[model samples]
Target: MNRKPSTIPVPVLMMIGIVAISFSSIFIKWSAAPASIQGMYRLLFTSLLMLPFARPYSGALFALRKKDWIMLIASGIMLALHFLLWMGSLKFTSVASSTMIMALEPVFIMLGAYFLFKEKTAVSALLGMGIAIAGVIFIGWGDIGISANNLKGDILSIGGTAAVAVHMLIGQKVVVRMPSYLYSLIVFISASFVFAIYNLLMGIPFFDYPPREWGIFMLLAVVPTVFGHILFNWLLQFVSATTVSMNILGEPVGASILAYLLLGEQLTGLQWTGSLLVMCGLAAYLYAGRKKGKDIAPVLDNAS
Candidate 1:
Protein backbone atom coordinates (compact mmCIF):
# COMPACT_ATOMS: atom_id res chain seq x y z
CA MET A 1 0.00 0.00 0.00
CA ASN A 2 1.18 3.54 -0.76
CA ARG A 3 1.69 5.94 2.13
CA LYS A 4 0.41 9.48 2.18
CA PRO A 5 3.01 12.15 1.50
CA SER A 6 4.02 14.27 4.47
CA THR A 7 3.62 18.02 4.28
CA ILE A 8 4.73 20.92 6.49
CA PRO A 9 2.12 23.04 8.24
CA VAL A 10 1.36 26.11 6.15
CA PRO A 11 0.20 29.03 8.29
CA VAL A 12 3.20 30.33 10.23
CA LEU A 13 5.83 29.44 7.65
CA MET A 14 3.88 30.91 4.78
CA MET A 15 3.26 34.14 6.69
CA ILE A 16 6.95 34.47 7.50
CA GLY A 17 7.91 33.87 3.88
CA ILE A 18 5.61 36.55 2.54
CA VAL A 19 6.69 39.10 5.13
CA ALA A 20 10.36 38.44 4.43
CA ILE A 21 9.92 38.68 0.68
CA SER A 22 7.90 41.88 1.10
CA PHE A 23 10.97 43.65 2.52
CA SER A 24 12.57 43.80 -0.95
CA SER A 25 11.02 47.11 -1.95
CA ILE A 26 12.06 48.87 1.25
CA PHE A 27 15.58 47.54 0.98
CA ILE A 28 15.81 48.55 -2.65
CA LYS A 29 14.69 52.05 -1.73
CA TRP A 30 17.24 52.24 1.07
CA SER A 31 20.06 51.28 -1.30
CA ALA A 32 21.51 54.26 -3.15
CA ALA A 33 22.62 52.31 -6.24
CA PRO A 34 20.86 52.45 -9.60
CA ALA A 35 17.91 50.04 -9.85
CA SER A 36 19.40 47.53 -12.27
CA ILE A 37 22.77 47.73 -10.58
CA GLN A 38 21.14 47.19 -7.21
CA GLY A 39 19.32 44.16 -8.58
CA MET A 40 22.57 42.79 -9.96
CA TYR A 41 24.33 43.27 -6.65
CA ARG A 42 21.49 41.69 -4.70
CA LEU A 43 21.34 38.64 -6.97
CA LEU A 44 25.10 38.12 -6.87
CA PHE A 45 25.27 38.36 -3.10
CA THR A 46 22.21 36.19 -2.64
CA SER A 47 23.57 33.42 -4.86
CA LEU A 48 26.92 33.45 -3.08
CA LEU A 49 25.28 33.34 0.35
CA MET A 50 22.99 30.51 -0.63
CA LEU A 51 26.01 28.45 -1.74
CA PRO A 52 26.55 27.03 1.74
CA PHE A 53 23.00 25.76 1.92
CA ALA A 54 22.28 24.98 -1.72
CA ARG A 55 25.73 23.62 -2.64
CA PRO A 56 24.98 23.67 -6.35
CA TYR A 57 28.46 22.51 -7.26
CA SER A 58 27.65 19.12 -5.77
CA GLY A 59 27.11 15.96 -7.84
CA ALA A 60 23.37 16.38 -7.41
CA LEU A 61 23.21 19.30 -9.82
CA PHE A 62 25.35 17.45 -12.32
CA ALA A 63 22.98 14.51 -12.11
CA LEU A 64 19.92 16.57 -13.04
CA ARG A 65 18.32 15.82 -16.42
CA LYS A 66 18.30 18.23 -19.34
CA LYS A 67 14.65 19.13 -18.60
CA ASP A 68 15.48 20.15 -15.01
CA TRP A 69 18.31 22.29 -16.31
CA ILE A 70 15.89 24.04 -18.65
CA MET A 71 13.45 24.70 -15.84
CA LEU A 72 16.14 26.17 -13.67
CA ILE A 73 17.36 28.46 -16.41
CA ALA A 74 13.82 29.51 -17.26
CA SER A 75 13.04 30.19 -13.62
CA GLY A 76 16.18 32.27 -13.27
CA ILE A 77 15.51 34.32 -16.40
CA MET A 78 11.87 34.92 -15.50
CA LEU A 79 12.76 36.00 -11.97
CA ALA A 80 15.45 38.33 -13.30
CA LEU A 81 12.88 39.98 -15.53
CA HIS A 82 10.48 40.16 -12.60
CA PHE A 83 13.00 42.05 -10.51
CA LEU A 84 13.90 44.28 -13.41
CA LEU A 85 10.33 45.41 -13.96
CA TRP A 86 9.54 45.63 -10.26
CA MET A 87 12.57 47.74 -9.35
CA GLY A 88 11.97 49.96 -12.36
CA SER A 89 8.34 50.44 -11.32
CA LEU A 90 9.46 51.89 -8.02
CA LYS A 91 11.35 54.65 -9.80
CA PHE A 92 8.18 56.08 -11.32
CA THR A 93 5.57 55.16 -8.73
CA SER A 94 4.85 55.30 -5.04
CA VAL A 95 5.62 52.25 -2.94
CA ALA A 96 1.92 51.85 -2.28
CA SER A 97 1.00 51.92 -5.95
CA SER A 98 3.77 49.56 -6.99
CA THR A 99 3.02 47.05 -4.25
CA MET A 100 -0.72 47.11 -4.84
CA ILE A 101 -0.18 46.52 -8.53
CA MET A 102 2.36 43.79 -7.86
CA ALA A 103 -0.15 42.03 -5.63
CA LEU A 104 -1.74 40.76 -8.82
CA GLU A 105 0.85 37.95 -8.88
CA PRO A 106 -1.33 35.38 -7.17
CA VAL A 107 -4.14 36.00 -9.63
CA PHE A 108 -1.86 35.23 -12.54
CA ILE A 109 -0.43 32.23 -10.73
CA MET A 110 -3.88 30.77 -10.25
CA LEU A 111 -4.87 31.42 -13.83
CA GLY A 112 -1.57 30.12 -15.19
CA ALA A 113 -1.71 26.93 -13.17
CA TYR A 114 -5.22 26.29 -14.34
CA PHE A 115 -4.33 26.80 -17.98
CA LEU A 116 -0.74 25.60 -18.23
CA PHE A 117 -0.61 22.79 -15.70
CA LYS A 118 -4.27 21.87 -15.83
CA GLU A 119 -4.52 22.22 -12.09
CA LYS A 120 -8.12 22.10 -11.04
CA THR A 121 -9.29 25.27 -9.38
CA ALA A 122 -11.77 25.02 -6.55
CA VAL A 123 -14.77 27.31 -6.50
CA SER A 124 -13.17 28.85 -3.45
CA ALA A 125 -10.08 29.70 -5.50
CA LEU A 126 -12.18 31.44 -8.09
CA LEU A 127 -13.97 33.34 -5.34
CA GLY A 128 -10.71 34.24 -3.62
CA MET A 129 -9.30 35.53 -6.91
CA GLY A 130 -12.38 37.69 -7.32
CA ILE A 131 -12.02 39.12 -3.83
CA ALA A 132 -8.34 39.80 -4.34
CA ILE A 133 -9.03 41.53 -7.67
CA ALA A 134 -11.69 43.68 -6.10
CA GLY A 135 -9.27 44.65 -3.36
CA VAL A 136 -6.58 45.54 -5.92
CA ILE A 137 -9.08 47.59 -7.87
CA PHE A 138 -10.13 49.42 -4.73
CA ILE A 139 -6.54 50.28 -3.83
CA GLY A 140 -5.74 51.23 -7.41
CA TRP A 141 -8.71 53.58 -7.59
CA GLY A 142 -7.60 55.46 -4.48
CA ASP A 143 -3.83 55.86 -4.74
CA ILE A 144 -3.02 54.96 -8.35
CA GLY A 145 -4.63 57.90 -10.06
CA ILE A 146 -3.97 58.17 -13.79
CA SER A 147 -0.94 59.98 -15.16
CA ALA A 148 1.60 59.04 -17.82
CA ASN A 149 4.06 58.13 -15.08
CA ASN A 150 1.50 56.16 -13.11
CA LEU A 151 0.45 54.28 -16.22
CA LYS A 152 3.98 53.38 -17.09
CA GLY A 153 4.70 52.12 -13.58
CA ASP A 154 1.45 50.20 -13.52
CA ILE A 155 2.32 48.49 -16.81
CA LEU A 156 5.75 47.53 -15.54
CA SER A 157 4.31 46.20 -12.29
CA ILE A 158 1.85 44.05 -14.19
CA GLY A 159 4.64 42.68 -16.35
CA GLY A 160 6.60 41.87 -13.22
CA THR A 161 3.65 40.02 -11.81
CA ALA A 162 3.32 37.94 -14.95
CA ALA A 163 7.01 37.11 -15.05
CA VAL A 164 6.98 35.87 -11.47
CA ALA A 165 3.94 33.71 -12.08
CA VAL A 166 5.66 31.99 -14.97
CA HIS A 167 8.71 31.48 -12.81
CA MET A 168 6.71 29.88 -10.00
CA LEU A 169 4.69 27.70 -12.32
CA ILE A 170 7.83 26.34 -13.94
CA GLY A 171 9.47 25.99 -10.52
CA GLN A 172 6.60 23.89 -9.19
CA LYS A 173 7.12 21.32 -11.90
CA VAL A 174 10.90 21.20 -11.39
CA VAL A 175 10.68 20.93 -7.61
CA VAL A 176 8.40 17.93 -7.80
CA ARG A 177 11.01 16.13 -9.84
CA MET A 178 14.18 17.17 -7.96
CA PRO A 179 15.34 18.35 -4.57
CA SER A 180 14.14 21.89 -3.91
CA TYR A 181 17.53 23.05 -2.69
CA LEU A 182 19.30 21.96 -5.85
CA TYR A 183 16.62 23.46 -8.04
CA SER A 184 16.75 26.76 -6.15
CA LEU A 185 20.52 26.91 -6.44
CA ILE A 186 20.19 26.75 -10.19
CA VAL A 187 17.59 29.50 -10.06
CA PHE A 188 19.80 31.79 -7.97
CA ILE A 189 22.82 31.19 -10.17
CA SER A 190 20.86 31.80 -13.32
CA ALA A 191 19.33 34.96 -11.93
CA SER A 192 22.73 36.28 -10.94
CA PHE A 193 24.05 35.57 -14.41
CA VAL A 194 21.12 37.29 -16.09
CA PHE A 195 21.37 40.35 -13.86
CA ALA A 196 25.11 40.61 -14.43
CA ILE A 197 24.58 40.56 -18.18
CA TYR A 198 21.80 43.12 -17.91
CA ASN A 199 24.07 45.45 -15.95
CA LEU A 200 26.83 45.08 -18.52
CA LEU A 201 24.44 45.73 -21.39
CA MET A 202 22.79 48.75 -19.78
CA GLY A 203 26.13 50.33 -18.88
CA ILE A 204 24.77 51.18 -15.44
CA PRO A 205 27.42 52.89 -13.29
CA PHE A 206 28.06 50.35 -10.57
CA PHE A 207 31.58 51.35 -9.50
CA ASP A 208 30.52 54.54 -7.69
CA TYR A 209 28.03 52.99 -5.27
CA PRO A 210 29.12 53.57 -1.64
CA PRO A 211 29.51 51.10 1.23
CA ARG A 212 26.08 52.07 2.56
CA GLU A 213 24.42 50.80 -0.61
CA TRP A 214 26.43 47.59 -0.41
CA GLY A 215 25.28 47.10 3.16
CA ILE A 216 21.66 47.45 2.10
CA PHE A 217 22.22 45.01 -0.75
CA MET A 218 23.70 42.46 1.64
CA LEU A 219 20.72 42.78 3.95
CA LEU A 220 18.38 42.30 1.02
CA ALA A 221 20.18 39.12 -0.06
CA VAL A 222 20.02 37.61 3.41
CA VAL A 223 16.43 38.50 4.17
CA PRO A 224 14.39 38.19 0.98
CA THR A 225 16.38 35.88 -1.24
CA VAL A 226 17.82 33.36 1.20
CA PHE A 227 15.41 33.53 4.12
CA GLY A 228 12.28 34.24 2.14
CA HIS A 229 12.80 31.75 -0.70
CA ILE A 230 13.96 29.03 1.70
CA LEU A 231 10.90 29.50 3.86
CA PHE A 232 8.59 29.55 0.85
CA ASN A 233 10.10 26.32 -0.55
CA TRP A 234 9.90 24.70 2.88
CA LEU A 235 6.26 25.69 3.32
CA LEU A 236 5.34 24.13 0.00
CA GLN A 237 6.25 20.72 1.35
CA PHE A 238 3.51 20.96 4.00
CA VAL A 239 0.69 22.90 2.36
CA SER A 240 -1.56 22.74 -0.67
CA ALA A 241 -0.67 24.96 -3.62
CA THR A 242 -3.90 26.86 -3.15
CA THR A 243 -3.04 27.47 0.49
CA VAL A 244 0.32 28.87 -0.53
CA SER A 245 -1.31 31.07 -3.14
CA MET A 246 -3.69 32.50 -0.55
CA ASN A 247 -0.83 33.27 1.84
CA ILE A 248 0.92 35.43 -0.77
CA LEU A 249 -1.84 37.98 -0.33
CA GLY A 250 -0.05 38.98 2.85
CA GLU A 251 2.96 40.36 0.93
CA PRO A 252 1.47 43.70 -0.05
CA VAL A 253 0.00 44.25 3.42
CA GLY A 254 3.25 43.43 5.14
CA ALA A 255 5.17 45.63 2.70
CA SER A 256 2.79 48.54 3.16
CA ILE A 257 3.03 48.35 6.95
CA LEU A 258 6.81 48.19 6.83
CA ALA A 259 6.97 51.18 4.49
CA TYR A 260 4.72 53.15 6.80
CA LEU A 261 6.89 52.34 9.81
CA LEU A 262 10.29 52.86 8.19
CA LEU A 263 9.67 55.54 5.59
CA GLY A 264 6.75 57.46 7.11
CA GLU A 265 4.62 56.54 4.14
CA GLN A 266 0.97 56.64 5.09
CA LEU A 267 -1.64 54.08 4.11
CA THR A 268 -4.98 55.50 3.02
CA GLY A 269 -8.38 54.26 4.17
CA LEU A 270 -9.01 52.58 0.83
CA GLN A 271 -5.66 50.81 1.00
CA TRP A 272 -6.47 49.57 4.49
CA THR A 273 -9.86 48.36 3.34
CA GLY A 274 -8.33 46.54 0.39
CA SER A 275 -5.77 44.91 2.63
CA LEU A 276 -8.54 43.70 4.93
CA LEU A 277 -10.50 42.25 2.06
CA VAL A 278 -7.42 40.46 0.80
CA MET A 279 -6.84 38.99 4.26
CA CYS A 280 -10.45 37.93 4.50
CA GLY A 281 -10.37 36.25 1.13
CA LEU A 282 -7.15 34.45 1.94
CA ALA A 283 -8.46 33.36 5.30
CA ALA A 284 -11.61 31.95 3.77
CA TYR A 285 -9.66 30.03 1.13
CA LEU A 286 -7.02 28.64 3.50
CA TYR A 287 -9.57 27.54 6.07
CA ALA A 288 -11.39 25.49 3.47
CA GLY A 289 -8.19 23.95 2.06
CA ARG A 290 -6.88 22.99 5.51
CA LYS A 291 -10.15 21.32 6.39
CA LYS A 292 -10.02 19.40 3.13
CA GLY A 293 -6.48 18.25 3.84
CA LYS A 294 -7.52 17.07 7.28
CA ASP A 295 -10.49 15.24 5.85
CA ILE A 296 -8.35 13.34 3.34
CA ALA A 297 -5.49 12.39 5.64
CA PRO A 298 -7.12 9.49 7.47
CA VAL A 299 -8.63 7.80 4.44
CA LEU A 300 -5.26 7.86 2.69
CA ASP A 301 -3.53 6.65 5.82
CA ASN A 302 -5.93 3.70 6.03
CA ALA A 303 -5.10 2.75 2.44
CA SER A 304 -1.45 2.70 3.38
Candidate 2:
Protein backbone atom coordinates (compact mmCIF):
# COMPACT_ATOMS: atom_id res chain seq x y z
CA MET A 1 0.00 0.00 0.00
CA ASN A 2 1.41 3.41 -1.01
CA ARG A 3 1.36 5.71 2.01
CA LYS A 4 2.66 8.95 3.51
CA PRO A 5 3.15 10.02 7.08
CA SER A 6 0.51 12.16 8.76
CA THR A 7 1.25 15.28 10.82
CA ILE A 8 1.31 13.06 13.91
CA PRO A 9 2.55 9.51 13.90
CA VAL A 10 -0.04 6.76 14.24
CA PRO A 11 1.45 5.50 17.50
CA VAL A 12 1.23 8.91 19.12
CA LEU A 13 -2.37 9.37 18.00
CA MET A 14 -3.17 5.88 19.21
CA MET A 15 -1.70 6.74 22.61
CA ILE A 16 -3.82 9.86 22.82
CA GLY A 17 -6.94 7.93 21.93
CA ILE A 18 -6.13 5.34 24.57
CA VAL A 19 -5.62 8.00 27.20
CA ALA A 20 -8.90 9.66 26.29
CA ILE A 21 -10.83 6.42 26.67
CA SER A 22 -9.12 5.58 29.92
CA PHE A 23 -11.34 8.20 31.51
CA SER A 24 -14.43 6.21 30.60
CA SER A 25 -14.27 3.86 33.56
CA ILE A 26 -13.68 6.71 35.99
CA PHE A 27 -16.62 8.64 34.61
CA ILE A 28 -18.84 5.60 34.70
CA LYS A 29 -17.93 4.96 38.31
CA TRP A 30 -18.80 8.52 39.21
CA SER A 31 -22.21 8.37 37.58
CA ALA A 32 -25.31 7.01 39.33
CA ALA A 33 -27.59 6.45 36.34
CA PRO A 34 -28.43 3.12 34.74
CA ALA A 35 -25.77 1.88 32.34
CA SER A 36 -27.94 1.89 29.23
CA ILE A 37 -29.34 5.31 30.06
CA GLN A 38 -25.86 6.71 30.52
CA GLY A 39 -24.85 5.10 27.23
CA MET A 40 -27.88 6.55 25.40
CA TYR A 41 -27.27 10.08 26.61
CA ARG A 42 -23.55 9.89 25.99
CA LEU A 43 -24.09 8.81 22.41
CA LEU A 44 -26.93 11.27 21.97
CA PHE A 45 -24.76 14.12 23.18
CA THR A 46 -21.80 13.02 21.06
CA SER A 47 -23.84 12.94 17.87
CA LEU A 48 -25.39 16.33 18.68
CA LEU A 49 -21.96 17.83 19.39
CA MET A 50 -20.57 16.42 16.15
CA LEU A 51 -23.37 17.91 14.05
CA PRO A 52 -21.87 21.40 13.69
CA PHE A 53 -18.50 20.05 12.61
CA ALA A 54 -20.11 17.68 10.14
CA ARG A 55 -21.69 20.47 8.07
CA PRO A 56 -19.02 20.19 5.41
CA TYR A 57 -19.96 16.58 4.79
CA SER A 58 -23.72 17.05 4.94
CA GLY A 59 -24.25 16.54 1.24
CA ALA A 60 -22.07 13.46 1.12
CA LEU A 61 -23.81 12.08 4.17
CA PHE A 62 -27.16 12.34 2.45
CA ALA A 63 -25.74 10.80 -0.72
CA LEU A 64 -24.57 7.66 1.08
CA ARG A 65 -25.72 4.54 -0.78
CA LYS A 66 -28.18 2.00 0.61
CA LYS A 67 -25.35 -0.40 1.41
CA ASP A 68 -23.53 2.25 3.41
CA TRP A 69 -26.60 2.91 5.54
CA ILE A 70 -27.04 -0.82 6.13
CA MET A 71 -23.45 -1.30 7.18
CA LEU A 72 -23.49 1.76 9.42
CA ILE A 73 -26.64 0.62 11.18
CA ALA A 74 -25.26 -2.86 11.62
CA SER A 75 -22.02 -1.45 12.93
CA GLY A 76 -23.87 0.75 15.39
CA ILE A 77 -25.94 -2.16 16.66
CA MET A 78 -22.85 -4.27 17.17
CA LEU A 79 -21.26 -1.48 19.16
CA ALA A 80 -24.32 -1.26 21.37
CA LEU A 81 -24.36 -5.01 21.80
CA HIS A 82 -20.77 -4.88 22.94
CA PHE A 83 -21.61 -2.52 25.76
CA LEU A 84 -24.73 -4.39 26.73
CA LEU A 85 -23.12 -7.80 26.78
CA TRP A 86 -19.96 -6.68 28.52
CA MET A 87 -21.84 -4.83 31.22
CA GLY A 88 -24.21 -7.72 31.74
CA SER A 89 -21.27 -10.08 32.09
CA LEU A 90 -19.84 -8.07 34.96
CA LYS A 91 -22.86 -8.81 37.09
CA PHE A 92 -22.49 -12.56 36.81
CA THR A 93 -18.74 -13.07 36.72
CA SER A 94 -15.59 -11.82 38.34
CA VAL A 95 -14.12 -8.67 36.82
CA ALA A 96 -10.98 -10.62 36.08
CA SER A 97 -12.75 -13.23 33.99
CA SER A 98 -14.83 -10.65 32.15
CA THR A 99 -11.94 -8.30 31.39
CA MET A 100 -9.61 -11.12 30.36
CA ILE A 101 -12.20 -12.38 27.92
CA MET A 102 -12.89 -8.88 26.61
CA ALA A 103 -9.20 -8.42 26.01
CA LEU A 104 -9.46 -11.03 23.25
CA GLU A 105 -11.19 -8.41 21.12
CA PRO A 106 -8.17 -7.90 18.90
CA VAL A 107 -7.88 -11.60 18.16
CA PHE A 108 -11.49 -11.66 17.06
CA ILE A 109 -10.93 -8.52 14.99
CA MET A 110 -7.73 -9.92 13.50
CA LEU A 111 -9.44 -13.07 12.26
CA GLY A 112 -12.34 -11.13 10.77
CA ALA A 113 -10.05 -8.60 9.11
CA TYR A 114 -7.88 -11.34 7.72
CA PHE A 115 -10.75 -13.18 6.09
CA LEU A 116 -13.09 -10.32 5.17
CA PHE A 117 -10.68 -7.51 4.33
CA LYS A 118 -7.90 -9.79 3.12
CA GLU A 119 -5.50 -8.14 5.56
CA LYS A 120 -2.45 -10.08 6.63
CA THR A 121 -0.47 -9.51 9.80
CA ALA A 122 3.20 -10.20 10.25
CA VAL A 123 4.62 -12.83 12.60
CA SER A 124 6.06 -10.18 14.92
CA ALA A 125 2.71 -8.44 15.10
CA LEU A 126 0.95 -11.67 15.92
CA LEU A 127 3.56 -12.31 18.58
CA GLY A 128 2.94 -8.83 19.91
CA MET A 129 -0.78 -9.61 20.15
CA GLY A 130 -0.03 -12.80 22.03
CA ILE A 131 2.21 -10.97 24.46
CA ALA A 132 -0.37 -8.27 25.02
CA ILE A 133 -3.10 -10.81 25.63
CA ALA A 134 -0.84 -12.71 27.99
CA GLY A 135 -0.23 -9.50 29.87
CA VAL A 136 -3.97 -8.97 30.30
CA ILE A 137 -4.44 -12.53 31.54
CA PHE A 138 -1.67 -12.04 34.04
CA ILE A 139 -3.13 -8.78 35.24
CA GLY A 140 -6.33 -10.53 36.19
CA TRP A 141 -5.01 -14.00 36.84
CA GLY A 142 -5.23 -13.80 40.60
CA ASP A 143 -8.94 -13.16 40.54
CA ILE A 144 -9.99 -15.37 37.68
CA GLY A 145 -12.66 -17.82 38.80
CA ILE A 146 -13.74 -20.92 36.92
CA SER A 147 -17.14 -22.25 37.89
CA ALA A 148 -20.51 -23.09 36.48
CA ASN A 149 -21.70 -19.66 37.66
CA ASN A 150 -19.01 -17.93 35.63
CA LEU A 151 -19.84 -19.74 32.40
CA LYS A 152 -22.66 -17.44 31.43
CA GLY A 153 -20.57 -14.34 32.04
CA ASP A 154 -17.66 -15.75 30.10
CA ILE A 155 -19.94 -16.47 27.18
CA LEU A 156 -21.38 -12.97 27.38
CA SER A 157 -17.94 -11.41 27.35
CA ILE A 158 -17.02 -13.51 24.34
CA GLY A 159 -20.15 -12.31 22.61
CA GLY A 160 -19.24 -8.75 23.50
CA THR A 161 -15.78 -9.15 22.04
CA ALA A 162 -17.22 -10.56 18.85
CA ALA A 163 -19.70 -7.72 18.63
CA VAL A 164 -16.99 -5.08 18.95
CA ALA A 165 -14.83 -6.88 16.42
CA VAL A 166 -17.67 -6.72 13.94
CA HIS A 167 -18.26 -3.09 14.84
CA MET A 168 -14.61 -2.29 14.09
CA LEU A 169 -14.58 -4.24 10.81
CA ILE A 170 -17.66 -2.34 9.68
CA GLY A 171 -16.05 0.95 10.61
CA GLN A 172 -13.01 0.01 8.57
CA LYS A 173 -15.22 -0.35 5.51
CA VAL A 174 -17.49 2.66 6.04
CA VAL A 175 -15.04 5.24 7.40
CA VAL A 176 -12.82 5.03 4.33
CA ARG A 177 -15.70 5.64 1.96
CA MET A 178 -16.59 9.00 3.55
CA PRO A 179 -15.15 11.56 5.95
CA SER A 180 -14.67 10.01 9.40
CA TYR A 181 -16.81 12.37 11.44
CA LEU A 182 -19.70 12.09 9.03
CA TYR A 183 -19.53 8.34 9.17
CA SER A 184 -19.28 8.43 12.97
CA LEU A 185 -22.28 10.73 13.20
CA ILE A 186 -24.55 8.16 11.63
CA VAL A 187 -23.07 5.42 13.82
CA PHE A 188 -23.42 7.39 17.02
CA ILE A 189 -27.04 8.19 16.19
CA SER A 190 -27.77 4.60 15.34
CA ALA A 191 -26.12 3.35 18.54
CA SER A 192 -27.90 5.94 20.63
CA PHE A 193 -31.16 4.75 19.13
CA VAL A 194 -30.41 1.19 20.22
CA PHE A 195 -29.45 2.33 23.70
CA ALA A 196 -32.67 4.32 23.92
CA ILE A 197 -34.67 1.24 23.06
CA TYR A 198 -32.78 -0.73 25.71
CA ASN A 199 -33.46 1.95 28.27
CA LEU A 200 -37.16 1.90 27.46
CA LEU A 201 -37.35 -1.85 27.73
CA MET A 202 -35.53 -1.83 31.05
CA GLY A 203 -37.71 0.99 32.38
CA ILE A 204 -34.74 3.16 33.10
CA PRO A 205 -35.63 6.76 33.79
CA PHE A 206 -34.43 9.05 31.04
CA PHE A 207 -34.48 12.48 32.67
CA ASP A 208 -34.45 11.68 36.34
CA TYR A 209 -30.71 11.87 36.77
CA PRO A 210 -29.21 14.69 38.86
CA PRO A 211 -26.82 17.33 37.57
CA ARG A 212 -23.75 15.37 38.60
CA GLU A 213 -24.96 12.39 36.62
CA TRP A 214 -25.64 14.60 33.63
CA GLY A 215 -22.15 16.02 33.89
CA ILE A 216 -20.77 12.49 33.87
CA PHE A 217 -22.75 11.68 30.75
CA MET A 218 -21.44 14.78 29.02
CA LEU A 219 -17.89 13.92 30.00
CA LEU A 220 -18.39 10.40 28.67
CA ALA A 221 -19.52 11.84 25.35
CA VAL A 222 -16.71 14.33 25.04
CA VAL A 223 -13.80 12.31 26.32
CA PRO A 224 -14.33 8.68 25.37
CA THR A 225 -17.00 8.83 22.70
CA VAL A 226 -15.51 11.69 20.72
CA PHE A 227 -11.87 11.78 21.62
CA GLY A 228 -11.56 8.04 22.15
CA HIS A 229 -13.95 6.28 19.76
CA ILE A 230 -14.29 8.95 17.09
CA LEU A 231 -10.54 9.24 17.00
CA PHE A 232 -10.30 5.48 16.51
CA ASN A 233 -13.00 5.68 13.83
CA TRP A 234 -10.98 8.34 12.02
CA LEU A 235 -7.89 6.15 12.32
CA LEU A 236 -9.49 3.17 10.56
CA GLN A 237 -9.01 4.75 7.14
CA PHE A 238 -5.26 4.74 7.58
CA VAL A 239 -4.54 1.60 9.64
CA SER A 240 -5.84 -1.94 9.43
CA ALA A 241 -8.72 -2.78 11.78
CA THR A 242 -6.60 -5.36 13.60
CA THR A 243 -3.90 -2.76 14.18
CA VAL A 244 -6.52 -0.38 15.57
CA SER A 245 -7.88 -3.14 17.78
CA MET A 246 -4.40 -3.91 19.04
CA ASN A 247 -4.05 -0.30 20.14
CA ILE A 248 -7.01 -0.82 22.42
CA LEU A 249 -4.81 -2.89 24.73
CA GLY A 250 -3.36 0.36 25.98
CA GLU A 251 -6.70 1.39 27.43
CA PRO A 252 -6.45 -0.99 30.39
CA VAL A 253 -2.95 0.20 31.19
CA GLY A 254 -4.00 3.82 31.02
CA ALA A 255 -7.09 3.13 33.04
CA SER A 256 -5.06 1.43 35.75
CA ILE A 257 -2.79 4.46 36.11
CA LEU A 258 -5.78 6.79 36.22
CA ALA A 259 -7.44 4.56 38.76
CA TYR A 260 -4.35 4.75 40.91
CA LEU A 261 -4.09 8.54 40.87
CA LEU A 262 -7.75 9.49 40.79
CA LEU A 263 -9.51 6.71 42.59
CA GLY A 264 -6.84 5.95 45.18
CA GLU A 265 -6.66 2.42 43.88
CA GLN A 266 -3.36 0.68 44.49
CA LEU A 267 -1.72 -1.23 41.68
CA THR A 268 -0.38 -4.65 42.50
CA GLY A 269 2.99 -5.96 41.41
CA LEU A 270 1.28 -8.06 38.76
CA GLN A 271 -0.45 -5.01 37.35
CA TRP A 272 2.84 -3.14 37.04
CA THR A 273 4.43 -6.09 35.32
CA GLY A 274 1.39 -6.53 33.08
CA SER A 275 1.52 -2.88 32.09
CA LEU A 276 5.16 -3.23 31.13
CA LEU A 277 4.47 -6.27 28.97
CA VAL A 278 1.59 -4.50 27.25
CA MET A 279 3.81 -1.52 26.41
CA CYS A 280 6.53 -3.78 25.10
CA GLY A 281 4.07 -5.69 22.98
CA LEU A 282 2.73 -2.48 21.52
CA ALA A 283 6.27 -1.35 20.76
CA ALA A 284 6.91 -4.61 18.95
CA TYR A 285 3.68 -4.25 17.01
CA LEU A 286 4.66 -0.76 15.89
CA TYR A 287 8.10 -2.01 14.95
CA ALA A 288 6.51 -4.77 12.89
CA GLY A 289 4.32 -2.25 11.08
CA ARG A 290 7.26 0.04 10.44
CA LYS A 291 9.40 -2.86 9.24
CA LYS A 292 6.68 -3.76 6.76
CA GLY A 293 6.49 -0.12 5.56
CA LYS A 294 3.36 2.05 5.31
CA ASP A 295 2.72 3.24 8.82
CA ILE A 296 -0.08 5.64 7.99
CA ALA A 297 -1.46 5.81 4.48
CA PRO A 298 -2.43 9.17 3.08
CA VAL A 299 -6.14 9.84 3.42
CA LEU A 300 -8.09 9.32 0.26
CA ASP A 301 -9.89 12.60 -0.50
CA ASN A 302 -13.18 10.88 -1.15
CA ALA A 303 -15.78 13.07 0.53
CA SER A 304 -18.37 10.58 -0.60
lDDT of 2 at 18: 81
The CA lDDT at 256 in model 1 is: 79
Pairs with steric clashes in candidate 1: 7-238, 8-238
Q: Estimate each model's TM-score.
A: 0.80, 0.75
What lDDT is reached at residue 297 by model 2?
28
* Model 1 TM-score, 2 decimals: 0.80
Candidate 1 on 1-304: residue-level lDDT in tens?
A: 2434446445666667778878878887776677777776777786677678665447776778897888789888998888888888777655766776676665687689789878666787578767867776665565565446865776787788888878877886777777666666678678878988887888876677778888988887778765575565554446545555554556677787888889887756876776666566656545555555521111000000
The candidate scoring highest on lDDT is 2
Q: Which candidate wins on TM-score?
A: 1
Once model 2 is optimally superposed onto the true structure by TM-score, how far is the C-alpha of residue 119 displaced, in angstroms?
2.7
